[model samples]
Target: MTSVTARTEREVTRGRTRRSLVRRETWISAVVLLLPAVVLLLLLRIIPTVTAMAEAVPLGGERSPWSNFAYIFSDPSFLNSVWVTLLFSVIVNPIQIALALALAVLLTKHIPAVGLWRTFILLPIAVPQAVSAIIWLVMLRPDGPLNGLASAIGLPTVPWLTEPGWALISIVIVCSWVGVGYWMTFLVTGIKEIPSSLYEASALDGANGWRQFWSITLPGLRRPLLFVLVADTVSNFLVFAPVRILTQGGPQGGTDLLMHNISERAYTLGDTQAASAATLVLVAIVIVVVTIQFRMLPGKED
Candidate 1:
């Protein structure tokens, strides 16, 4: 009896050892599979960012980093560019999110030709941003179709791209039009992920559509909404192409964004150090905004 018991104990110990070995092998395999992505991120993103930060620290030669940063701060125009970027991010991000949410809610319902509507909405995203900006620029021209329609209705032609006040507004309108559909896609996906049973329960409780959305849909969508908020803020802050192709930060620098200013300084003025410094400042602003967003997000304990 004692000998039999000893043999059974040995077998159980061996099985445990095998299970341990299998777990280790699985963990190692996962790490190996993830290695390529980790390496790519380091090579493409981390290394370049570190290099940029290093380049931003001047070595006391021509265009010293300190002098470059000082120049940006000292110039009233550059300071205005910073303010413009902040204003754009603040205004565009929330408005885009709200509009996208509204559109997503509308399209996700039992509407007719839903697929066609979604396709049309998302078609703008398929077009290159630069191309879209150019198309809008043409449409907003003083003698373009929009103005022609306005004139036919006895309304004066508004200088969409030529006036300082209207220039920024025109850029914002184009940016929102191009971006809202893309953002709506994310919200639609988020909304669809919600369980149908929850909606049924809310209906049984005599809850209206808006109340159900506020309680059920919004809670389930918190994470995705947070993600969209951060991403939109980053994208808006780095806005450049529209300003570059549409207005060239013109109409007296009304549409001058930080990225446009940086590009002009780096490529046109040949001020690499200054551009690097400006880029660093942009990065810092993004970090701060993201941090604040994360901190303010609900479910912090979780």
Candidate 2:
């Protein structure tokens, strides 16, 4: 019996050893396959970032390293652009996330023509942003269909794109129209991943729809919500085409966002160094805000 037990132990040890060797070889093969792509990613991302940072620093005898940054801060138009970008981000991020969440929840319900409605909701995402901006520009013009309808209804004929304040609001509407559907897809996917059994059990416990949503859906969507917030904030910060095509950062520079300002600096004024500095500022803002979000968002520690 002792000899039989010893033989069994020897076989088990040999099996573990073989499995370890196979796992090691598989890991090595995977790394070997992935190394090229990893190197390319670093070359594309890190090298450009380092180069841009170096360009931003004015390396001369008289100029300070932060001279570009100083010039940007001193420029009134640039300051206004920063403020517009921040205000736009603050307003649009919540609206988009909330609207997307609401739509995602509604779609998950058994409404009539549900699939068709979802298709209609997502159709805006398929339209290119530039095309959408042009369409919106036509509609929001002073003599456009929207104003015509307002005139018929005796509502005031308001300026949409011509004015500074209205242009920013119009831009927000356009962004929400284009972005909510895309964000909704992520939320719907997240909601679907949650087990239905939880809802069923909650219903049995006399929990209503709102209660279930608060207790289950909201908690289930922490990661997805975080992703949407960060991504949407970044996208909104970098919005360029609509402002360029519609407002051109006009009406006293009201809609002059960060990206538009950066482009104007880089392309129009031939100030690549200033643009690089502005890019760094934008990158820093994104990093700090995203880091704060990461810390504040719910997790296992919380």
Candidate 3:
């Protein structure tokens, strides 16, 4: 009996030793696989952010270390850019999300050639934003195809990229055209993940389409919707290519978003310090907005 007990103990010891070696090997493999991505993120994102923050600080000779920030706040152009960016965010985010959600629902239904339709919608995403902006630039010209079509339809000509108000609206249109399809793809994935059994069960209980959407679809989509909202808000806030290529901050700074404003200050006016300060402000705004979104749309604990 004693010999049997010793044999059992030895077997247990061997099992644990083998398990420990396997666990160590797994960790080493994980680190090796992740190392390249970690290095790239540090080089691309962290280093640039640190450099921007360092550049934003005023030199020792200044009356205050926050001179750059003060200057930016005092500037009317910067203030206008902030207001414009806020307005753009408010308008563009909802439009993109709503359209994307609608398309996701429609495309996910039992429709013919759904994959082809999805590809057509997502084709814009394959095109670079700068190129898309340039294409829209021509399309929005006073004598361009859009206005020509308007004339043919007996409608008045619209100053798409020429006027301040219309320029902002034109930017919104261009952005939405590209963003809606991209966002829809994510929502489609989210919708697909929801179990079909829920729909079937709800149908048996006589729950209609709208009821099922309200009860199951929305609840199932909570996490993906939250992600889409946060990501869309951030991307809209960082909008520059469309504004730069189409309007160049526009006829009277009407479409001068914060990113374009920063570029103008840094590249056009040679104010790197102010640009860096504005970059920090933009980062702060994104952080605050994302925090609020997380609080408002808290994900369910698993």
Candidate 4:
């Protein structure tokens, strides 16, 4: 009896060793196959980032990257542009996220023509940002369709692009309209991944649609929500096209975003060092925002 027990233990141990060996072998093979992808990413992304960082830090008789950064703070216009970028992100991010969440919930219902509705919502993603900006620019012209409709209704044809105060709001409206659909798709996909069993159980417990969404759906969608928040924040901060096409960062640089300012400084003003420093600051700000977002998320502590 003792000998038989010892043999059984030995067999179990050997079987475990074989499984572990197989897993290691499989992992090694996978890594080997992934080597080319790793190399490509390093070359394309990592190398350029390092180069940019190096360019941002000027050394010796050359305009140091630090000086370039200082210049941004010293220039009142640049400081105003930074503030504008922040305000734009703060105003647009929550509104866009809320609209997207609401639309996701609406579309997930068994509404008529649901497929068509989804297709329409997703169509904007296929439209290029530049093209969308141009289309909005045309529509917001002084005598464009919007003004025509306003005139027909005996309402004022407000100066959307020409007025300084209204210009930023116009850009924001266009940005939100173009962006909401894309973010809504993410939320819709997240909601679809939730198990129907959870909803069925909630129904059995007398939970209504809103309750189920708040308790079950929202918790399950935490990761997707985090992803959207980070992405939308970064994208909105880097907004340039609508400003360029619609307002051109005017009538008094009200809509001049960091990217637009950086581009103008680099190309138009021939100050590559200053532009590189500004670009680095923008990158750093995005990283900090994303980090804070992730840290504040519920499960991030775990």
Question: What's model 1's lDDT at 274?
Answer: 78
| lDDT minimum window of 10 residues, candidate 4 | 56-65
Question: What is the number of residue pairs that collide in model 1?
Answer: 0
Residue by residue across 1-302, what tens digits does model 1's lDDT show? 99999999999999999999999999999999999999999999999888777777867577655776787799887898888888777778888999999898899899999989998988888889999998998899989989999999999899999998788888888889888999999999999999999999989999999998899988888978988888988888888889999899988888899999999999999988778888999999999999999988885445
All models: lDDT?
0.88, 0.92, 0.93, 0.87
Per-residue lDDT of candidate 3, residues 1-302 (tens digit): 99999999999999999999999999999999999999999999999999898889856764688888989999999999999999999899999999999899899999999999999999998899999999999999998999999999999999998889899999999999999999999999999999999999999999998898899988898988998999999999999899989989988999999999999999999999899999999999999989999998866786
lDDT tens digits, residues 44-118, model 2? Answer: 999999989998996874889999999999999889988998998998999999999999999998889988888
lDDT at residue 290 of model 3 (Cα atoms): 90
Give me the candidate number with maximum lDDT.
3
For model 4, the stretches where C-alpha displacement exceeds 4 angstroms are 1-40, 62-65, 300-302
**Which residue pairs in model 1 clash with each other?**
none
Write out the backbone clash pairs for model 3: none
Model 2 spans > 4 angstroms off? 1-40
State the TM-score for model 4.
Answer: 0.83
